[model samples]
Target: MQRYFVAPEQFRGGAVTITGEDAHHALRVMRMKPGDKIIVSDGESRTVLASVTELIPQAMKADILEKLPQDSEPAWSVSIAQGLPKGDKMELVIQKGTEIGAAEFLPFESERIVVQYDAKKESKRLERWGKIAKEAAEQSHRHRIPAIGPVRSWKELLATIPDYDLAVFCYEREGDAAQGVGIGAALRKFREGKLLSLEEGRTPSVLIIVGPEGGFTDREAAEADAAGAVVAGLGKRILRTETAGIVGLTCVLYEAGEMGGE
Candidate 1:
C-alpha cells in the first residue's frame, strides 16, 4: 500500500485530509480513486490504514480504518551532524541517513570544510534536503521524517552537545591510537548505560558528528573531546565524508538492535 505523511491536524475525527503534492501523486500519478486503500501517517507516530473516500482537484480524503502498529522508529534518537561537503554529497547523506533511522541532520561549517557558505542559496538547499528526507521516509515506511536543521558553525555545533545523552565524534586519528575506543565500543558503552544524560528519564538521544572531505583539524578534535563527545574510530579504512555518517549511523542502530531481529 502507498504511504503518505501529513500534518497532525490533517488527521481529525476519523478521517485524513491529503493535499498538495501528495494529493497530486494519489489523484494523478497513482490514478487513485474512491475506495482505494492506503497507509497514512501524521508524522508524529500516529499511522493508520485508511481507505480513500473522496477525491477532488488537488485533494483527497480518506477515512481511518484502523491504527497501525508503531515499530519503524529506532529505540534511540540518532542525529547526524555533518560538516558541509562539496557537490551533492549532502543530499545523498540526508536521503540514505533518513532511511537508516537518523532522527535529524545537522550540517555544519568546520575549519577544514571546502564548500564556501552561500547565504542566498541556503533556503533552496534546505527545502531540497527536506523533500529528499520526506520521500526517503515514505519509501522506507518510516513513521516520522527526519528533520533538517539549519547549518551551524563549528562552535555552535559543539555547544549543542548537552542536548543529547551521548555524542560520538568520528576522528580518523583514532584509528592509529593504541587504546582508542572504536565505534562499536562507544555504542556498547551507551548500551550498558555508562553514558548518563542531564535529563533524568527519557529515551537516550545520540549525536554522531562527521567531518567534511578535508576532515577536522587537530585543534577541532581536541575541542570536540572537551565538549563531552566520545571520539570513535570508524575502522582501519578511512571512509569518505559522505559515507562516514551513514556507516556510523548504521553502527548505532545495529548496536541498539534496530537492524533486525534481536
Candidate 2:
C-alpha cells in the first residue's frame, strides 16, 4: 500500500488532515480520491492505515482504520557523520543511508574536504536532505525519518557528540594493517562475538565518520581517534569518498542483523 507521512497533531480523532505538499501530491500527482486507501505515518514512528474520506484542492482528510508498529526501524540506531562530498553525492548518501536504517546524518567539514556549503546554502541543503530522508523512510516503511545535522568542522565533529556508545571512523589508508583489525574483521567479531548485550540493541548505537574525496588527513584522523572513534578500514582495496560511507553503513547493518538475517 502507498504510504504518506502526517504529523501527530493532524490526527484529530477519526480524520487526518493533510496539508502542504502532501495535499498537493494527493490532489494532483497521485490523483487520489475519496474512499481511496493508503497508509499514513505521523513522522514519529507511528503509522496508521487510513482511508481517504474527503479530498479538496488545498486539503485532504483520511479516516484512520488501524494503527500498527513500524517494523522497518533497526533494533539499534546508527548515525552517519559524513564529510561533505562534491556535487549531488550527499543526496545519494541520504537516500541509501535511510534505507540502511541510519538514525541520523551529520555533514562534517574535514581538512581534505573540497566542497563547502555556505551558511545560507547549508541551511537550504539541510532542509532538502531532511525531506529526502523523510520520503525514503516512508518508502522503506521506516518508523522514524533520520534527522540530518548541520555541517560541522573536524574539530566540531568530535566536540559535539560525545555520548554515543560506539564510534567508528573509516580511513582508506589504514585498516587491520595498523590496528590488526580491519572493518570487515571488526564487523565479523562484532557479529559473532558475544561482547555486547543484545538488549542494548542489534547494531549498537554507533557514530560512523566517512571522510571526503581526498580522505582524512593524518592530523584529522588523530583528532577523531582522540575523540573516541575507532579507526577501521574497509579492506586494502581503496574506495571512493561516496563508496566508503555506503560500505561502512552496510557492514554495520549486516553485523547488527538488520540485513542477510536468518
Candidate 3:
C-alpha cells in the first residue's frame, strides 16, 4: 500500500488532512483520487491505515481505519554529528540517515572541511535538508521525522556530549584504539535477555560523530577523545565520508535489538 506523511496539526479526531506540497504530490503527481487506499503516518513514529475519503482542490482527507504502532524504530535514539562534506553528499547522508532511524543530524565544521556554508545561504540549505528528511521518513514509514540541526563548530559539538548516554566518534587515526568490541558484541553482552517493554527504556541513546571528506585532523581526534566521545574504528578498511554514518547507525540499530532476528 502507498504511504504518505501528515503533520500532527492535520490530524483531527480520526481523520487526517493533507495539504501543501504533500497534497500536490498526492493529487497531481501520484494521481491519487478519492476512495483509494493509502497509509498515513503522523510523522511522530506511528502509522495508521488511512483510506482516502475526500479529495478537494487544496486538501485531501483520509479516514483512519486503525492506528498501527510503529515497530521499525530502534529503541535507541542516535544523533549523527557529521563534519560538513562538500557538494550534495550531505543531502544523501540526511536521506539515508533518516531511513535508518536517526533521531537528529548535526553538521559540524572541522579543520579539514572543504565546504563552507555561508550565513546567507545556510538557512535555505538547512530548510531543504529538513524537507528531504521528512520525505525519506515517509518513504521508510518512520513515524517521526528526524531533525537537521544547525551547523556547529567543533567546540560547540563537544559541549553537547554530556547530554547523550553514549557518544561515538569515528576516527581513521585511532586505528588500534578502534578495535573495541563491535556494536553487536556490546549489545549481546549488555542487553541480551532483557524484557521487551518500551517503558523500561534500557536501550542506549547514541551520538555519533563523523568527519568530512578529508577527515578529522589529529588535534580534532584528541579533542573528541577528551570530550568523552569514544574514538571507535569501523573496521580495517576505510569508509567514505557519506558511508560512515550508515555503518554507525546500522551498528546502533542492531545493538538496540532492531536487526537480524534471533
Q: Rank the candidates by lDDT, best first.
A: 1, 3, 2
Residue pair clashes in candidate 1: none
Q: Which candidate leads the pack in TM-score?
A: 1
Compose the digit string of candidate 2's lDDT tens values, residues 25-78. Answer: 888999999889888888775688899988888899999888877777776678
How does candidate 3 score on lDDT?
A: 0.81
**What's the TM for model 3?**
0.89
Clashes of 2: 0
lDDT string for model 1 (82-193, tens) is 9999999999999999998999999999999999889799999999999999999999999999999999999999999978888999998887644477999888877767
Q: By lDDT, is 1 or 3 better?
A: 1
lDDT (CA) per prediction: 0.92, 0.81, 0.81
TM-scores, one per candidate: 0.95, 0.91, 0.89
Candidate 1: regions farther than 4 A off: 177-179, 195-201, 260-262
**Model 1 TM-score, all chains together:** 0.95
Give the TM-score (vs. native) of candidate 2. Answer: 0.91
- Using lDDT as the measure, which candidate wins? 1
Task: For model 3, give the RMSD to the true fold.
Answer: 3.1
